[model samples]
Target: MPTNGWDTHMHVTDPSYPEAADAEYTPGQHNLSDALSFESTIGINSLVLIQPSIYGNDNTLLLNALTKLGTRHGRGVVGFDTDATSFETLQAWHQLGVRGVRLNIKSNEVNLTEAELQERVTRYAKIIQPLDWVLELYIGMEDIPKLEPVVADLGVRLSIAHFGAPTLPPIGNRTLPLDPYTVAGFQSLVNLLKAGKTYIKFSGAYRFDKDPQYRGIEGIARELLKFAGDRIIFASDWPHTRFEGLDIHPFVEKCLDWTDAAGVTEKVFSRNAHELWDIPLDK
Candidate 1:
């Protein structure tokens, strides 16, 4: 772990908060203490608490965690009803270390038509423009091609979770055909990277590969590095809801190994996050 790095994505669930009635899956309870403990063990000192789909628009748990961690050690990204959330509410959250909003499309089971998707992204982008915060999406690889045009020139930063959460084609019974070129919407994703308004998170390898170590996915990272290593951000994807029991120790090493070879380990692991999220640790 980068001792001064930020885990830009992760979630903490408290059972006291009511779960969304239609939550895709309830996460096993992971407290703020537990999250801090694990990250400390790995040598990571900062965190970003992402609002899990199960929490819907309720951010009580998230706010409490942020209050405890404060801006010096924590920042947050929340999920909200775009229509219902007020500017005052967002401003309040901003003061408490909330730096972004997320569309839980993948986990919340959103199936917007291409036009609907475009409109939605536009709304979110426009809402956060004044706040200088990012608009994050939990969409899949296939959605990237559809998402690129809408986000390309939005003038606000959009961060994609889990390397686009790409589901690559299987090569054979024993081999993984994990090439980004073989994946849908990859070029569109790269196009947005080049356009300079997007950030790609190095996280959720388990979503791309079922292997515990997430083997054979370096092609995706290398290609991402090739196009925009400086824009890449590393995250722990902590407690790893939906994909439990994953040994992330080696997986993180693999990401570093690749970034080191590309000569952007510092950028990906530290500098990019400090810039994109405006984390204030160094100051």
Candidate 2:
């Protein structure tokens, strides 16, 4: 198949970094060359390399890869300390096709006080606002309520990572495991969609459920699709972290399956991504 789709989430490992050893999940022996090969196989022409927790704020590896790919094959979603990164630095990154920054509150294994988190997000908004970059949040499901006001206050485009990072058991329920809190959070996503302030990537199903077939996981994905079809974007989470054992193709296929059901494959797989990230699509 000819590659034409855009993968909104993936990580490329930089062996040169000493921190690679500490990674609980690292992309398997795959460099940018390997990633391009895999993307070719899956019919993915472009990808967004998210900053993995292992790399922390050291984005040298991701930056180097983007430099090599030169924005044709790759773009980046980087992580940085707002205190450390200057607005001019963010502007330079944007010129290189970085349209968003990753905030990994959950995987970084650090809990922030509500005030501290707010301060950090607020500072980031100040820097990123001028560049028109969105904030991509990787946080736990329970944290969404606290995050709502931060997102509202910042007023930058927001993208939630990994289906709001719901707890594994409810995801494992294999039926529509509905809880009041989860229902409320799902509704919040709908509201964000309606307001045109947020987008959610349908990736990381493996993190949500161990079953590769993703039995019960489909229900949650379907519900999210129902809430916001065009606002949804599909991703492979390729070389799927912590679950490298699973084939990348199946992950992409499952996302396609959910998009098909939602009747938003065109937008989710291609259109919305281009519009959001400013990547060019084949006409």
Candidate 3:
């Protein structure tokens, strides 16, 4: 393992904190101590606690965890209402180790027009540009193409979650007919990676491939590694809200197999995300 390995994406759910009224999923309690313990067990030095969608724009739990966990060992990616949030609050969150804002379009069907979605991300990009932060997205597999130009033109770092959430083909073929939106989105994601305009998180293998060994998912990982190995980062996706009772070790090991190059896991697990978020490495 690299000395400063980081789990770049994960969530913390506390029952006491209460989920948003409109939350699509009712998450059971998963808190700061549990997260810290998991990281320790994995021998990782730092972690990035992403604000779960259950909390909506209220990031009290995430900020409190960052404060308690200390900035050196923790970072946060929070959700906010760009329309109502002030720059001062954004700067304050930045001071507390928040380096990115999440735009989770896949959580629920937002019923928004493409123009509305574009306007929303554009506003967020403008707000965070000064802080040099990333816009972390959990968009649907098909929406990637629609949002590609907005993210590219916004001039801020963009990180796509869940291996770009590729639309899977039928088993055995490795290549098959794909829906127009899926094909377009996957191709756009590849083009963006080639241009060094975006980054991908090699996390949530279970989301893409349900096999215990994560067999079929490797094809997508291989493609990503082939295109932008340097831009891919690893995350445990711990406390895997929708998918718990799944051991992370196997998934963690799967991250290393994405590329055959020596020390590739070291780069994806430690260097890529640390550099992207400007986390200080242990000497």
Candidate 4:
């Protein structure tokens, strides 16, 4: 790990068992104390706690964990309904060290429509812009095309989840699907990076590859890194959802190997996180 490194992405489940299945995945169980141990082993000095979808908009558990972890070791990314979360409430979260908001559109659990989606995105942009917080998208790659125009229209900085959600085998072939809309979305990400309006997290290789070892995903990551290495950041996606069988450290090590440092590893591992999330470090 780079000196004073921070893991830009992580999640902690709620402490209470509102639902038995959800409770199993709680941060108190999978992260919290466990994360400190993992950080020690990995040499990451700081971390960001993203609110897991299991908790929906109730960020109390995540916030509690952040409070316990303390500012020196933690920051947060919360989830909220743009229609429901008022500006004052958002400002409070910002003061609590929340540097970003997560738009978990992929799960479809929240069930938003095109109009509602656009409205929420706009509202979030309006609220977070003054604080300079980012909007993080966790959705399918195909869906990105539908969402790009709104993001561009809003003039807010955005982060696409999982490396532009590249289409590879078991999803789409290596060449990427030829759908014009998808093509436009992928190009939109490149354009956004070129214009310095967006960023991508080089995380969750397990989510992209059908193979457990993540053999071919590196090509997609390199493609993004080629265009926006400085803007790209790395993440462990700790307690990887549905991928508990694999060792997290080895996956992280493989990602490090795939990138080959190329002089960009430092940025991916630490520097970009500092710039994007305002993570404090000794350097």
Best by lDDT: 1
Higher TM-score: candidate 1 or 3?
A: 1
lDDT of 3 by residue, 1-283 (tens): 6678889999888777777888887776778888878888788858898988889999998898888877888889999987789999999999999999998877776755778888888988999999999999887666776776676689788889988776565456444222323443778788778878688998887876666766667766766676587899888899988887778888776676555453477778887887888786551
Number of the predicted model whose TM-score against the real structure is largest: 1
lDDT of 2 at 24: 59
Give each model's whole-structure lDDT: 0.83, 0.74, 0.80, 0.72
Prediction-by-prediction clash tally: 0, 2, 0, 1
Instruction: For residues 93-201, write the lDDT of model 2, one tens digit per residue.
Output: 8878788888888775668877877787788777788777888888776666666666766868888888777664554353444332344355555666667778888
Better of 1 and 4 by TM-score: 1
Question: Candidate 3, clashing residue pairs?
Answer: none
**Model 4 over residues 125-244: C-alpha lDDT tens digits?**
887888888888786665555665577777578876677666555643544322323332566666667777678887787776776656556665656777688788887887676565
Q: What is the lDDT of residue 33 in candidate 2?
A: 87
RMSD of 2: 2.7
Better of 2 and 4 by lDDT: 2
In candidate 2, list every pair of residues with a backbone clash.
Answer: 3-43, 174-216
Ranking by lDDT: 1, 3, 2, 4
lDDT of 1 by residue, 50-99 (tens): 99988888988999999999998888999888889999999999999999
Report residue 171 deviation for candidate 1 (angstroms). Answer: 6.3
